[model samples]
Structures are given as C-alpha cells and as structure tokens.
Target: MTDATLAFAHGDPHQLRGMEGVGIAHDGPAPKRIVTGYGFWIFLLSDIVMFSCFFAAYAVLLGQTAGGPSGAQLFDLRSVALETGCLLLSSFTCGLATIAAGVRNERWFQAAMAVTCVLGLVFLTLEGREFASLVARGAGPTRSAFLSAFFALVGCHGMHVSAGILWLLTMMAQVLAKGFRADIQRRLLCFALFWHALDIIWVGVFSVVYLLGSAV
Candidate 1:
C-alpha cells in the first residue's frame, strides 16, 4: 500500500499533512454544550446588533422633538434607576442559578431562577408604568420623532425581558420534569448566556438612554 494510503487507513487524512499545511483539524463534532452555547452567542450578537440600530436612531432623533417635550422634561431618573437595580440584581441571581446547575443542585437552582424571574418581572412592571405615565402626559411615540425612537428602543428591550421571563419559566419546568439531563443542562447554559447578555444590554441602555437623556 502507498504511504499516504496507509496513513489515511490508520487515522484522519488531514493529520497526514504537516502542521503548516493542515487545515482545521476535525476531532469530531463539538459537544452539545459547546455547540449550543456558541450558537446562542451568535443569536445574542445579532440581537445586540438590532438594538444598536435602535440606539443610533434614538440618538439621531434625540434633538428632533418637533418642539415637543424633551427627554429632560419627561424622563424620571429615580424610576429608571429603580428599574436598573432590579435588572442588575436579576443578573446576580442568574449567576447563582448557573452555579447551582453546575453542581446539579436542583433546589438551589430552582430558587435562584425564581428570584431571577421575579426581578425581571419587577423591572418590566416599572418600565410599563413609566411608559404609561409618559403616554398620559401626551408624550406618546406618535407625538414626536424623539418619542418614537425612544419607545422603539426602550420598548423593544421591555419586550425582550418579557420573552426572557417566559423562557425562564420554561426552563424551570423542564428541569422539574427532566432533572437536568445533558440536553437540559446545555439549554440552561444557553439561558444563562442569554440572561447575562440582556443584563449587559440593559446597562448600556440605562447609561445612554436614561442617564444621558435625563441630563439632556
């Protein structure tokens, strides 16, 4: 048999080449956990890109208030600060849940996840109230370009939080029913990533949209 044929018969054909000549080495498919986490990261990055566009729009329209109420006139810093606190605390609880999941401690995992969900809900409630108050004050999205962009950016984030809460509940149910099978664990990892990403995005929103806007 030829030397190359012998090498191919013994192991991966790609390994026959020198290090510099070889392409990416395939050591079989990546584990489900890694694959799942990587795919979710891609999804999260895409979501962030979408949010970035909204942020850019908000910035451009920030001064185009059409002689309507400005952000400084409408934004309540105290309320926004409270909302930020809830979301940030939820992120901490999410980390606890991920740690518990690593140890397969079902009780602790569920409790941490529950706290995370509650905090997320609290954030949504505060945001909903803020939106309602603004609308009542004739600051609805249709009133001006500034208001429209603001609603599009902040409201989209609120919707994401709502979706995350639903996802959190689903994860809890799956754990209760399946007891953290490998697939479930992989899913939990993805959830943790998603939740943390949302928290990061919220930090940006609070800094740029709320703090800066109120100051303006």
Candidate 2:
C-alpha cells in the first residue's frame, strides 16, 4: 500500500493527519461561553498587570513629597474604612446577583444588582469626597510626586469601579429586555468576572496604599 494507505491502516486517517487533535479532541469550535470567558480572563489579566505597574510606581514614589503632605498626613482612616465596607458588601451582593441569574430569578436578580449598584455608588461618593478633601488641603496630584502616585493608583481604581457600575446597569437593562438570553448571560458572566476582579484589586489597594501608606 502507499504511505497514506499504510498510515490509515495503522490508525484513523484523520488522526494520522493530526486533524482530529487540532480541535483538542473536539469536533468543532469551543462553546461560546468558554471562548468568551477565556477571552475575558485575558483582558482581566492585562488589567491586573497594568495595576501592578501602578502599584510599583506608587511604591517607588511613596515618599517623594516635595515639602508637601504625605499619605499619613492626609489619609483619613474613617472614610477609607467606610469605602472598604461598601465595596466589600457590594461584592457580596454581586455574588447574590450571580446566584439569582443562575436560577433565572428576574426579581431577585434585579433587586440584588440594584443593591450592588447602590453600594458601588456609595463607595464612589466617599472616594470623591476624599479626593475633594485632599485637593482642598493642597494635596492634589499636581502638588507632589507622592500625591501624584497616590492619585494615579487610587483614581484608576475608582474609574474602573465607575465603568463597572455602568456595565452593571447595562447588564440589568439587557436582562430585563432580553429575559436571560444566552448572549445576555454571557455578558453577565463577563461582568461578574470583571466586578470580582475589581474587588480583589481594591483589597490590594486597601492593604498596600491605605494601610501601609497611612502607617508610613
């Protein structure tokens, strides 16, 4: 027999050609959900890397205040504590929203998401007030390298939270209009991943920036 015939006789012709394993033992494309989630995770990882760079920059410039206020001088533990509580609680409500979505419970899902949105708003409001207070006290980003690093790190996180809130609202509207459609569900899953990621990043910020910065 010819080489092709011999190879086919030894095993499956497609396997011999390596075509069967090309799909990773599957016959077609991966499920949409898996593909979407994997892509979203890549995006999340890139975001994390960016935040890590910001953190490193902040650390390097932590004490670069040119005769200006430092974090320990300007940091308010009470407001930071309240912000932390709101964000952490929002993470919990976000979990409940995910659970409700899984069960296709529209009412509960909406309610949970609404609560999450409210908590996120509260967190942002507190952050905004804190920023305003800092700026009023001549500690704005332009005041010193230390303040610049602090604002860049914390402000970036706040922008992400704001974006997440907008995305959360969009998800709510999509679900209400589409009734848990597959695409809607996929978007919701991505949103959950993004939101949870923000929560984790915030924890890091709280520990590194707020806690450590305040102590120093």
Candidate 3:
C-alpha cells in the first residue's frame, strides 16, 4: 500500500485498541481463547442483567400472596438445602475439570465433568420435585403474584443450570472427539465461567428468595 495510507493506519488512535503498541499491530486476529472468553463474559453479563430484573420483580411482589400460600408456607428449606449442596459440589467438580483441562489430563477431566453433571442432575431433580409439590398444593404460579415472581426468579436460575448441564455434556463429547484442541479448550473455559456464574446466581436466589422470603 501507499506510505500515506500506512501512516494513517498506523497513526489512527482507534486502531490502538486492537494493537499491542502505537504502531505495531497483531499479525492476525486476537487469540481464540481471549476472544472467546471476552464474548462469553458479555453473554454472562447479559444473563446477570436478566436475573437482576427477576430479582427486582420478586422483591416487589414478595408479599403479594393474593390470599394464597406464600414462600414461608410453601418453601421446603430441607429440600432447598440439599439442592444447594448438590450445586456446590458440582461447582467444585467443575473447577477440577477446568484444572484437568489446563493440564491436558483426559481421564480426570472426563471424570470430574461426569461428576459435575450428575450433581447438577440431582439438583434439578430436587427442584423439580419441589415445584411439583407446590403445584399439587394449588400454590402454582397463577395462584398469586408472589408465586408468579417466585417461580420466575427461581425457575430462571433452574433453566440456566439445566443449560449448563447440557453444555457440560457437549464439552465432554467434544473433548473426547477433539482431545483438548485449542478451540475445544476455549469452549471448556467458557463452560467453566458459565457454570461458576450460575452458582453465584443461585447463592443470590438462596439468600434473597429463600431466606429473606421465608422470614418475611
């Protein structure tokens, strides 16, 4: 190209965002892992924003029982505690899986991921049972504003967990087929980030929706 064009390109301040230095630029696109992680982080932030709205709705409608049962009457603390344990254990195993991925240990990665998936399944099962019991008691979402908000907030988190379980299995399948290829590793990293964020959101659910709601 011409010197003037090159000068304009090299001197453009906007280009500095992608360049390592003022004049020098990366030879190719950003590393796949970094780009993948950044994109997934944005996805996570958007998910959090969605959950924040749910939290606000639940908070506002917390006391709107409409003459039906409320959280204090419907929530089974024992079941919720067990579900929390399962998720916490799954998160731990997920961390181990991430470490195994970093070390390129196929066996440990598969085993840890399997354990995480099982724990997540157990969590979902317990949550499903709890919802069933509530519905059987005529305390379904349509029963009251409180029930609707409660179901929306908790069910959103449960849906994320369900998606995470699916993603974990997909990651496992790809690892077996691809054997930790760079792209697969980046996907695994994103999976870890997504799973951990779910756990964080669940903690909020436990604290605000369960603990506080029960007391109120």
lDDT of 3 by residue, 1-216 (tens): 754456566786554454445455447888788999999999999999999999999999999998888788888888899999999989999999999999999999999999999999999999999999999999999999999999999998999899999899999999998899988888898999999999999999999999999997
Instruction: Summarize candidate 2's per-residue lDDT along 1-216 as a digit string, tens digits.
Output: 755556567877565675444333536788999999999999999999999999999999988889987789999988899999999999999999999999999999999999999999999999999999998988889999888989999999999999999999999998998899888889999999999999999999999999989887
Model 3 residue 56 CA deviation in Å: 0.1
Q: How should the candidates be ordered by lDDT, best one leading?
A: 2, 3, 1
What lDDT, from 0 to 1, does candidate 3 have? 0.91
Residue-by-residue lDDT tens digits, candidate 1, 1-216: 865556678875565774333453566887788888899999999999999999999898888889999999999888999999999999999999999999999999999999999999999999999999999999999999999999999999999999899999999999999897999999889888988888999999998888878777
Clashing pairs in 2: none
- Alpha carbon lDDT at 37, candidate 3: 96
Q: What is the lDDT of residue 206 in candidate 1?
A: 91
**lDDT-better candidate, 2 vs 3:** 2
Candidates 1 and 3 compared by TM-score, better number: 1
TM-score of each: 0.87, 0.87, 0.86
